[model samples]
Target: MNTIAHSTPVAIASARTPSFSPWRCYWLEAKHELLRLLRTPSFVLPTLLFPPLFYVLFGVVLAGGRSGGDMGRYLLATYGVFGIMGAALFGFGVSVAVERERGFLTLKRALPMPPGAYLLAKMAMAMVFAAIISLILAVIAVSLAKVSLQPAQWALLFAINVLGVLPFCALGLCIGAWVSGSAAPAVVNILYLPMAFLSGLWLPLQILPAIFAKIAPVWPAYHLGQVALKVVDRDGGGSLALHLAVLGVVTVAFFVLARARLSRSQ
Candidate 1:
């Protein structure tokens, strides 16, 4: 009884341990998150490879002759968007659902770390992956596809791809909060692939039946693809403000919904 009594305080004190510094704490959290995901081959391999492979096949190798450059530039933007969406959705959605199912989220809450650090870390990881995907696509476009663009256009497209992960991250968070670990992957794919195709990421919306073009705006990926396409001057014509507004609303709305679901879970 004496030993048990003595150890209890130490455990409590450890649970309430002081962080070294707030900024350092956040950095460590994010660093570890990146490391953890990097070690997961299932996530790292597909997230990094699929986009570039598809870009190579459909965007470059299949470019046929004269229109190769246009196809390369256009798909570079769209596939970059596709790559980031996977990073955000899988990085957050499947992981969050699994962690929650295993009570890891609750355990984190019980720790002395900062609350936002967990989320911020995931977001940072997704952004890093997004930047990487964009870079790889850019390199492929330059070397293999023979695609060229103004330096400003390159930088702008990179910015759009990196920043574009946000709304998808929010959407993923919502999925993670609502679904079971086993179901999250299936749910994300159901939403991910169809949205990508419907948004004209795989094929131009013009050739799709007219109905798809009419409803394309309903999907956030379409808006993102448009903004990215606009950077290359291939977008199907619309106000840039409108795309930004839809993306902004999506980011805010899904985040709010996820937060509500998470809070209730607690």
Candidate 2:
């Protein structure tokens, strides 16, 4: 009877305790998403290759022998933003759309996982990719391109690039929830590359056109670029207030729209 009584309490305690804690689940899910990204050649290749490649070509080769102004420094910040933006958008956007269409999202939802864990996992993975891109670019800039900055400045630039991926993640979510799997890639590319160029990720915003320069602040990447440039003391005269406000508004609006679209689909 004592043994039975002890067994009964233990059984009750086991029933009360969760099979898996939320934090544990979150960690596992995030790790799973990171692994998924790492294993996929299509995802890993472009995200890993493009930023460093661009920096080596434009920020290094073309930027070579120009010992005056720090063009390499400029490209480092801008291309860092460019690289993170691509990783966040394509990683989250394509995967989210494909999962939803394949019913995997529904399956994940049916599991014991917390709601939005999948989204969080993708964001975490995007940050990981952003870190790698920033590191590679910084190394290339310092070693090959001779773009030097104080250690603190390098840290600041890296942080800016990593955090700047958030707004694009929201935009990606909005696009993913609204579009089909096939359409998501084309839509993302169309929206991404042009905005990067027009936002001065490739060339100066001033060189684009009068109209393009005037509208540059409208692009999220432009705000990110401005902040990044300021890290190395080469800002383009944008107010910090405007940059923060614009990114905050864009993030909130896009996330709300994505959630609404997802709700409707269900």
Candidate 3:
């Protein structure tokens, strides 16, 4: 009775003590997360290689010598947008799903890491990959395709390309939160190819069926393509404000959904 009484207060005190600082815990996890991605070639290789190959096959070889300057510029812009989507969807989304299934997320929760840092690190990495891929495509466009844009144009195009990934990143998070690893790639492909095709990333809007052209504006890919087209060609036909607004809305919506889904899963 005396020993039990003596230990009770200590147990109570320890229970009241904080286990870990959220910030420190998150920082450590974020570093590990980044390292995990770096070590995974399945994630890195497709992001680095696919865009340029798509450009070579579709933009150059298939496009042949027929497209005018505006059409050529549009192809580059759209393909760059396509590349950004690949990183955000496959690289981030599938990885998150796999991590969740593998108990990594559960481990982080057990450690009580700061929620924001883990997500911020993922977003940061996605944006970094998007920027790097965009640069590579830009170089390819300039070198092989002889595509040229003024400095301001280049800056605008790059900005749009980077910003365009955010909403998709959020969407990827939602997918990651919901799907299993085996199903994730299939879901991503179903979403990716359709969005790319319908949104005119595979080809110009003019070349697409009229119905698709009419509905393209509703898709995030279309807005991204619109912003990219505006920058690459220095055209201002589409309302930049509208594109930005739609992307912002989609990002917020997907993030909210992802958060809810994650909480439920926990």
> lDDT of all the models against the reference?
0.94, 0.88, 0.81
Query: What tens digits encode model 2's per-residue C-alpha lDDT throughout 1-266?
Result: 35544468788999989777899888999999999889999889999898899889987788774845477878888999999999999987888899889988889889978997888999999999999999988888878988879999998988987888899999999989988998999999999999999999887775567888888888999999999998877668879889988998999999999999888888
Q: Which residue ranges in model 2 land beyond 4 Å of their true spot?
A: 1-19, 67-69
**Model 3 quality (TM-score):** 0.84
Scanning candidate 2 in windows of ten residues, the lowest lDDT window is 1-10
Best by lDDT: 1
Clashes within 3 Å, all models in order: 0, 0, 0
Candidate 1 regions with alpha-carbon error over 4 angstroms: 1-19
Candidate order by decreasing TM-score: 2, 1, 3
| Tens-digit per-residue lDDT, 66-151, candidate 3 | 54555557778888899889888986689889889998888866754565777877877777778888898888777777676788
Q: Which 10 consecutive residues of model 1 have the lowest summed lDDT?
A: 1-10
- TM-score per prediction, in order, is 0.92, 0.93, 0.84
